[model samples]
Target: MRGPAAPPPQPGWALKAATAVVYAAILAWSVFSRGPEGLQAVAMLALGYAVILGLIVFAALAFFSLWRRFRTPRNRARVMLGLGVFLLAAVVPPFAEHNDDNRQRDIANAEIRKAIDTLRQQAAGGSGAPEDVPAIDPAPRASGPYGEMERVMKTVAGARLAQHRAYLQELQEIGLPRLFDARRLARDTGLIESRLILEQAERLVPGYRRQSLDVLNGMPALVRSLTIADAEKDKILAALQTSNAASNAKLTRLWDLESQILREFGQMITLLDDNRQYWYADKNELMFGRDGDLRRFRQHQESVSRMVGEQEQLGVQSLAAVPQAPLR
Candidate 1:
């Protein structure tokens, strides 16, 4: 008679329950740690489930072994240790990567904020004094079209465009109420700067009034974009005072309008850039002998004008597409 009746066989239900608890715990931890932001959360859960499933399969195979390998406590302990190692390997990297990404984003946002403050100050006319203006050399003027003066003007225009683009991008990142404030600052500064540039152009090339005028005319369109954005924001806020459904619908329209406005703003900037190039090239032709450059320049101007006209038409269409309020 065997050693005192064999102890009752261990139930498979207990083993299954234990495995399920471990799986659930791992999944919960992954989700909570990642906070459901990106693919990393999904990946972590998938990997955890895969590892657990593999361990379940391995245990099943070992239990069915002809030699009964899993029957021994020592073999089971080794199997558990291997599973732990595999689980650790599968889980650690994603968390580390997510932490690094968050840290870098914080640093970048801080730098952007600092830059926006500096730009705001400069836009408010924080430059030192009128005496700070660097003196331009008064060398004898070259008769050729591509003279030193024209070169200098091109350089300055390019620099201004770059600075404006950076400022716009920064404003866009900050979003809303602040966006309007920054834009107002930019608009005021731009108008003043445009007038000054026009005056300088008149002095440099007396007959170049038309080109400068075209450049000046584009400035208002840019400013109008800012005004439209502000008006739309106000309208959205006003709409929120009504019923929830109407408010939500208005908000959707406002979002669509803001997107369209941004697109138009970008296009307007591109058009202005083209205008600047055309103006300088045209000025050069007037000074130097006419060449193929002038023909290409005119073609570019026409293309940009057509684009601007299309943008205007789209703007009108977008306004029309907005649903009218129901009569009370």
Candidate 2:
């Protein structure tokens, strides 16, 4: 029977206090549920607090203009919408399991560590921790570089090459070691054989090279990256694949070479890091052209890149006529 008095305006601090109480209630429940794991409970509470706080700030700004008392009626609608979104957000992240990012990053790091160990096993004679992947190495041969080179040449020159992109599938299944018979050879064996194999590989593979110290240093990183790449991983595997069984073993040797190169390069970088001032001096000297502990790393990279490109071109030209599947 009486006209309604104007509704009281809600104070900003009151809304914030209510939000804080809701959060505190949620945190208490979490702590009670995880009593023995108090540290974990605390961590969860902190996370929840951050997410909720972010939501509160976001909602406050979003709704301020929408509230009629705060601003205009139109602004009030916008603010209401923002508050709804913020409330929804506050409830979502806590239920998100909190371990998704840590899980994924842990998996990536695990894969990298496994790959490194795999390299060590293969290099040390194919043995190590319970690995899902087997490490295989090339055996050293009595044949000299020239003879090895001839073998590589024959492997490439045989002319009965299969050209198919699906070959990459075969590669992933077999791995780089399967591309060549590694047990029959070692570093010396490949120097000559590598010449031919590399010549062919330079063209046949998409991401590979035998020259350039910088690239040699980066090879393991590339391999590790490939093992973890979300897409185009096949390209990396393909580089390690070969149609010839003997070649597959040899390819494994190539993996060893790459591993050794990376290890050495990392060591070199460490050496540089230890002598930071010396490194800076030498780095600048090389770039500007005066020989003081100079390292021709960049120039070497460009020159080797050009040569590798040419060699790869020659390989593709040589094998272009061969019947094989197209690259994916």
Candidate 3:
């Protein structure tokens, strides 16, 4: 007996509205969280959602077919509800997690940028220990692939900054004054100090260069430690490569500048010795001859002064080359 042919299935306006709101909210949050830079991520997310949405639509058509196959209205409603719940469970969690991962990556990149900025500032300014610098604000260190890389990057940054700080201090403290003491051929304490500092810097610079080279060389292996998606990994690796090249170039310039200073110091010492025969130390006066010792002395002084100016200019250029954002 057909007991009042079953009522036609009604559209569930409430469920449809709720589903629209959920999808809209996720899309909105994704754009908002990533800013302008996140358009690619947002597009990827939208594509994933669209695929899921299409599957849901197909499932709805299947559910309609099942509705006709079923005998009772009660059975149809149960089947629809169960399928809807299953689809919701499958679709929502992954997108939510994708959103979460986006937020986390942004946070980590910001921290890394901040840390690199601090390093750039320190190296450019070339003053004070790391303690004198502002402390990095604390945040949850990202776990997984980024965690190890982040730590190592910051460590390398710190080492570079420390080396520059030490170099500047020694240069100002001991290098410049005796560097220009071209008239002092005596065994003075200041000259001794400068000589010792020059030898120390010469010894330390190669070590510093070696350390930097090691860091650059090991970067490929370090990148391999990350277990992120291939696309993401390649992006990070590119930035790291740029950063390494810049660091290496700057380090080489610094080494050259130091070498120039050391070489000038040695030349200045030689000039003092060569001109010592022309000076009467007791009278603080010069003995002149037709041999052109006086002319050579004047020329040496001018050359030393010009070299000093050159060093100053090189230092300025080196500082200017420092990246405002190293990791970018």
Candidate 4:
């Protein structure tokens, strides 16, 4: 019966139904997994696929029309020409859009690199706190075993020792002796001034003369006591000189240690500044898709922080070890 009625016109809609099912499944999954953003991404992908499919269909139609018009050579040539133009039109826009995006990205990257270079230059040229160590204050001049030892040390044979020796010797021989002489002179001047004041009071009032004589009688003993006090003062100064010598030695050692620590601290600061500059220069790489670079940068930062913390702690301990004077 007419070749089985052309096999019931084979169901061409079956393929389209299967495609629709696949698309629905993908959309459902996208919605379930990513919410609104997923839906947006899927919509964009679908739009792009639709455009591509439409282009393909148009191309296929043009090829089919060319075949159908092949009987007339002139018409065939014209159709082929039209198909080529249409194909170029369809392809060129997407390529141009892609090229434009690449150009924009390159321009942005170039600007970022230029900024990084400027930062690097600035960091390289920058200087911070002065690195020169401060001079230690001179030790006090006094008397006793410490002074004797210091006097001996001053004569030692090296240039370094010789300088310190000269300083201590000068303190002992000239500075302390001059200070003692000045103190004696001041005491005598004060005594003389007191006597003059009392004498003037006696001259102004006859009744006060008796009181002044009583005070004047006490003056010789006061002068004798002052002489005795001067002897005691010399003894005290001798003890102070010994104490001063020991204190000076300790202070010298502290100065040396502190200077070393300060130099190391300055170096650490410079290194940290350099590290900061490096981080700024590579910030885009660290922040964006460069996972490996980010990891390395973080590790370096932590290492440096830990090292500086340890050094600071050690410095604190060292400072604490130095003896401090008791508060009165």
lDDT (Cα, 0-100) at 246 in candidate 3: 63
Give the per-residue lDDT of model 4 (tens digit) for 1-328.
4554432223245444544554444334333333235667868766665576457555755666656544343443344344445544665457555545444434434433333333233223222111211122222122233222222222111222233233334334432223213233234332343334333322333333233233323322322332224564355445444454453443344334333433443343333334442332232232323555456545655664555454444323322211122101
Cα RMSD, each candidate: 23.2, 20.7, 8.8, 36.7
Worst 10 contiguous positions by lDDT, candidate 1: 319-328
Better of 1 and 2 by TM-score: 2
Model 4: ten consecutive residues of lowest lDDT? 319-328
Q: If both were scored by lDDT, which would come out higher, candidate 1 or candidate 2?
A: 1
Task: lDDT for model 3, please.
Answer: 0.56
Q: What TM-score would you give candidate 4 relative to the actual structure?
A: 0.21
The TM-score values for the models, in the order shown, are: 0.26, 0.27, 0.51, 0.21
Over the stretch 132-216, how does candidate 3's per-residue lDDT look in tens digits? 6554433337655455445555555555556555555655564553444434434443346556766766776676667656655
Per-residue lDDT for 31-66 in model 1, tens only?
A: 555556678867776687668666764775476454
- Return the candidate ranking by lDDT, descending: 3, 1, 2, 4
Over the stretch 43-101, how does candidate 2's per-residue lDDT look in tens digits? Answer: 87668766866676566866564644656433443454445455547754564343333
Clash count, predicted structure 4: 4
Local distance difference test, each candidate: 0.40, 0.38, 0.56, 0.37
Give me the runs in candidate 1 sitting further than 4 Å from their true place: 8-25, 29-69, 72-78, 89-91, 94-162, 165-197, 201-328
| lDDT (C-alpha) at residue 85 in model 3 | 57
